[model samples]
Target chain A: MAFRTDHHLTGSVNIVTALPAEARPLVGHFELRSSRTDPFSVYTNGDSSVRLIVSGVGKSAAGRAVKHLAGLFDSTGSNAWLNVGIAGHESLPLGTMVAAHKISDEKTGRSWFPPMVLDFPCETATLLTVEEETDDYPDNALVEMEAVGFYATASDFSTHELIHCLKVVSDNRREKKLDGKSVSELITAQLAAVESVVQSILQLSAELGKRRVVPRQLKDFLEQWKFTVTQSHQLEKLLRRWEVIFPKADPFEAASPESRNGRDVVQLLSRQLAEASVEAEQL
Target chain B: MIEAIYIEEAVRQHRRTAEILTRFPKARLIPCERYGEVFNPRSQDFKIQKRRPALILAEKFDNFVLPTPDGFGIGGTENYYFSHMLNCLYDCRYCFLQGMFRSAHYLLFVNYESFMDAIDSTLDKSTTDKTVTFFSGYDCDSLALETVTGFAEAFLPFFRERPRALHELRTKSVNIQALLKTEPLDNCVTAFSFTPAEISEKVEHGVPPVKRRIEAMKQLAERGWPLGLRLDPLIYHGRFESNYRRLVNDLFAAVPAEAFHSVSLGAMRFPKAMFDPMVKLYPDELLLAGPLHPSNGMVTYRREVEEEMTQFCRSLLGDYLPAEKFFHCAPWS
Candidate 1:
């Protein structure tokens, strides 16, 4: 059900999985509706937020799926990418949900440490993404099929904080076999843990969203002053700083120095900004 | 409070590393060949990672002891600085560490003995008459993480033996329980950094309040620990003179001025290289708005404002302590 021209895909959350069964419980629980106009099965909320994509198994598939979904649904780069699936841990009990502290691609032997800032009560473990499930859990990590691909691709789309993989332990060495129904049930059982992670990620997403958004006054100033490509970037960065330091003060309401070029305006703002900054720190 | 600790594979078997691992039994220990493999990546965002910084137990190779910048010392013959840690526990907005390193994670070089050996050799070569002052909190808070690293406990004895080489543990931390238990030595100076309570509440993230820091200094002074005051990077906040005056008047009253070993003062400044990046890192901070001008090569307060501030403080501080005890650090010193 995934489609092109996601102009209506103005969502803040993207949930991707390697299989349809793994994505089913989340889509159903969150009331995600599938569309008939897309090539892949994509479930979207009625509010046009929270897209669930069921990419086929393997690293390439997961990477391709993220690229496709991100291109269509995440124009803002603000969406949190959640790659959910079943993984095999050497010792963790079946159905145990552990958020990844470190994710390493088995074939490449490369690793990425996701800074676990949120203090969740659930157990934490390293994840090794392999091409296929293995009984020989080589290292002390949760073995999965889609993490590296998801992380490698999703991180390119959004911040690493916004891109994370939450896996449910479905197999270890002894319990290697699992049917589709069993996988679905295992994924469904860890929904609560998944929700907790989602909430934390969303909170981080929201905080970053505020910091990046340009205020209306800066936009108006940009329209009035002819800032060059370089100055515009500086202005944007400065305005974000302004919002942080002088949260209550209004940039537009401040006394305007009339008839100045972009350079002059920048200089004026810089002077006022510096004074305000120093003053703010003063007792 | 640490959720994850990235341990360098080389130090996995080190006794100190093992002992630290035992303390944080809950943190997931990620193994790597070198700390740089985990710490030197450009992909890591200092902002996002700052929300929850990991503890990297690493092994520092060279440059264990370096000379302090020309004006960084509080008066001495030969001043040298060393960092057993790469980063700090508290996040001060004005700190140069933010721009100096790409990662916000704290990297503790577990090989403290190597550093002491380096210090020992360096000090052994110097003449005993020339008082060599070694600064400890150059790259990180020397005492803020005392309990976690047992840094002060380990080094106090090292300095006690090397009486000719004085040690200054500059920190904003109040964790002096370790020092309280040991015999306070004159060769060691426990320097406490302070800012206006009003400014501290805003920019010095994760640091104890001004009152708490002052209390810690008083406790240390009472216990015979030679106390030094570092009013460095004095933020030029509004009505700074009154704030500073009240602060000094209040402080000198509690911890007798006679007990003070030294007091160093400096204005807030950043290298142009560090300033630009800091602007990007803390766009919302008023501190960077400084209409800061580049003098020579560093970005700092205007010459006039800097003079006024330093002169005012120098005059005010002269009222509390002996004129010889006050030291002025030039901007970016």
Candidate 2:
């Protein structure tokens, strides 16, 4: 709810899928426009941060697309990376949606656990990323083609909280098989669930960003003054203390050019804010 | 209801595991080498899996019982507690388990015989003639999963056999059917934890209401079961004094003050390690707010508030019962 109309301007999201059809619905819903074509078919809304990449149909493609997007927006690995696509499960009905609690590589017999910290109302299952489709299913996991590549790569680029995979079942052993068109339909049907998950990531990222960011007023003042890296960090802390002491108000409106240096400016603000806090408390 | 049952390969053929499996045929049975592989993984979110927590059946190895923290037990002697389970059936926001564990899956150690044997061996080292009590619900609510685990049914008889030794089934659960179905044991204490109904109704999600818990205590006390009252982690609001006074009045009105075997008073405190995780798990709750700081690696209410709340409640409790029947849980106390 807080992130509407933010694509291509600010905020961060990188979506990766196995096919263009799988990316089609998301590209439209996020209003993402076409962009760079380095690693794979890439689309964006012109903002450097929000992006989508079609990784073709295998692990390498998924890995390359992630590397490309990570180099673009997630150099700090704090932004969200979401892998949305269709998977096959043996018994789960077609079109059933699930979040991955476990992601395993079928070839290596190695698995990665996905932390399920937030309680969204969705059933969870383990997803096994296989190289090719086979007659026999290995375990009771959603069978997919790119989860391992997506998870292993995306995780290296972001914290586990910001990396997630949502899969909609496209085929089961006992059910009628699905084609490219049906797979697109299955994905389209679950866009609402995907949208909810996106909102959750944005909310979490925003919460984290709030704590990390300095106030715009403080940033402007710092840019004007030639402060060293360490002093900049100190200024950030003082700004936060100022905010906690005097919330919903700015302290820069009273600044005068009497401060001789960057350190003087910081001390002047800190002293004034401290006095203001003591006065407020007494009141 | 559990959506799946993950069984450790070692305990897959255990009779207890087999019996539980029969009851949940609809639930998917998953096999794993160890319960931690399923229960302790970081990816399995406690809040998410809690919506449909899977039951993990595994074998316990070593550390069957551990010493309780100082100022915790009823008597002024050395005390210890053990956990047959890891988490609770209810989702109380103040619960320490939220911070101590990353996953919310219910881990049921199928090897009860091993635990009983360990308890028996522990009591055999009798240093003095005075009775030493062993608490049963530190990491979990002891009787909360009684219907499914039959924990009290198994351990009550074990305690009954050794009358000199004691066991306390500490809980906030009203799942007393197994205990009520049979006779109550003198050596056992059915401890019911409580907070003011107003606070509990807000933060203690999934717990039976305070009225119902008191009703269950009444029935058990009438059957001659030694009852315990746990007012640990006492949450304070604007009207804390009036709210707590009302709770104590309502509690004593139903189950007479004389019926309580002992009452333990604990002010709201958290180990420093647990505070941040609990805060992260539920960031918007007012519970974490205060002009408070950590002291000696523990986070608690302001010193004056803690002392006032504890002293006020202790004085009130003292009016109804003797001094020996209450144990103060705050560090200063």
Candidate 3:
């Protein structure tokens, strides 16, 4: 699928929640509009940079929702994925916001540790995704469902650094269950923390987009000559070299009317750049 | 400062781990079964993680001290290298660590005693007449994290007792307070690596400036510590001759040539496996884009360019130091 030109999809954020109550705070804050409700409830902002999907309440449902959301957009690894929902801990108080440093699947015995490269403004805890709900909680960990599925599926599309899970403590030993209104209120109270984490991820994603940008002249070169897949790759590298070695000079000045195809252009550029005297930029 | 620290389950209660944890009280502590579980996974972006890398404390099981490549030494018949850490704190665009490791987190083996024991066994097996040199800072900077690791404070005294064994602490960091406080040992050489000031400022991120490093070296020389100069990986540029000449003059002017234990020169080269990833990490880096070609499974400057750059620097260095003090490192095989 191709991204809509009207939307800025690069450096975007895709949020997945297991319940509408869990996703309502984010959807309201980001000013998202309900785009569809067929397979799953989906909402998106006007620019489509911020998207949310509410999967109904199981691990398999969360996994399918993540896959469905990813299939709708052309995410270029620069977009961030966040799985935000409520979890249960043994002794922690309600409304305590915690980010997951480690995620484990109780049934599959699979685990993933998200690299904490950002200085998040929340406590960190281990998250255990169980197959069935239970009152028993692991020591020094938060218990929940859908995190394993959300994390495992999202990782196939993005790097581990850009994928994260944030959980708000809704139920504990003191409080076994919370009503839908209570769940929505708990998430609403910690909206600032959610915003902070999403902003940091967006900053990182934007920085990555800058690094992956191709030279502007590459498009013109492709239009001027016929290049096979292999030759196109070579042409891009050569153009980047030219841009670095001679920032102010035009690269086409080195090409001749005799050049008929991308192969000839690649060879000519390579030969010219090879003989050029390069200088390291002074600080 | 470290923001998070990943501790291996094996070393969670170790004395060194506890001490390191106390230094960073605010850091988030994450526990794992093995350092490899957090450090060796695929799909971890080196550049992104490098912005704020965590520290992984683990216990290394074996192979603490191993033989250096055939020509990677300075005047020692038997040369071996050991690393207490796996990655450097600085982010030089040309560093091979970015390509060699999947993750950018600093993996420091907390078991220093095990490394010392391995070195001692290697020394005992060596012939008494020949010097057994132990090279540090191959995989990471020896002194960059000295304040946190206490690596120099713990290992200096051990090397002081062995007169037949030599230790080379190679680094580009000016974190030499640990060395300054202790009495200078004759068997230990604190070597400093450098490129020209212009090239260093552009590529070597977070490294101390050239002037500050020279001042630190002068202080070490005054304290009677044997010093070494590493002009290795000579970056090729249009002003190579003038830049290198000025750098050599600045060093000799600050510290006397007699204080230098050795001087070495090597051309910039990387294995194809490493070069490809580094380019992918920093596509706009000028150093990687300049006049480099693949030959014999390694990426390096043309033979003539490498020889000319090395020969010019060697000739300039000869004016200040004798030929016996010079060592030229060949490209890695």
Top-scoring candidate (lDDT): 3
Question: Scoring model 2 with DockQ, what do you get?
Answer: 0.13
Give lDDT tens digits, candidate 1, residues A76-151.
5567788899888787789888888778888998887666777664777888888875687755788888889888
On TM-score, the stronger of 1 and 3 is 3
Candidate 2 has a TM-score of 0.77
* Model 2 lDDT, full chain set: 0.75
**Greater-lDDT candidate between 1 and 3:** 3
Residue pairs in candidate 2 whose N, alpha carbon or C atoms collide under 3 angstroms: A8-A47, A33-A44, A114-B43, A115-B43, A116-B43, A116-B45
Which portions of model 3 show Cα errors greater than 4 Å?
Answer: A1-10, A108-110, A258-260, A280-283, B127-129, B330-333
How close is chain A of candidate 1 to the true chain A, as a TM-score?
0.84
Model 3 lDDT, full chain set: 0.87
Candidate 3 backbone collisions, by pair? none
lDDT of each: 0.78, 0.75, 0.87
Least well predicted 10-residue stretch by lDDT in candidate 1 chain B: B324-333
* Candidate 3 lDDT over residue span B1-333, tens digit each: 898899998999999999999999998899888898789877789998998899999999999999988987778889899999999999888888898899999999999999999998998888767889999998899999988899999999999998888999999999999999999999999999999998899989999999999999999999999998999778888898999989989998999888899989888899989988888778777788767776788888888888899899999989988999986433372
Q: Is candidate 1 or candidate 2 better by lDDT?
A: 1
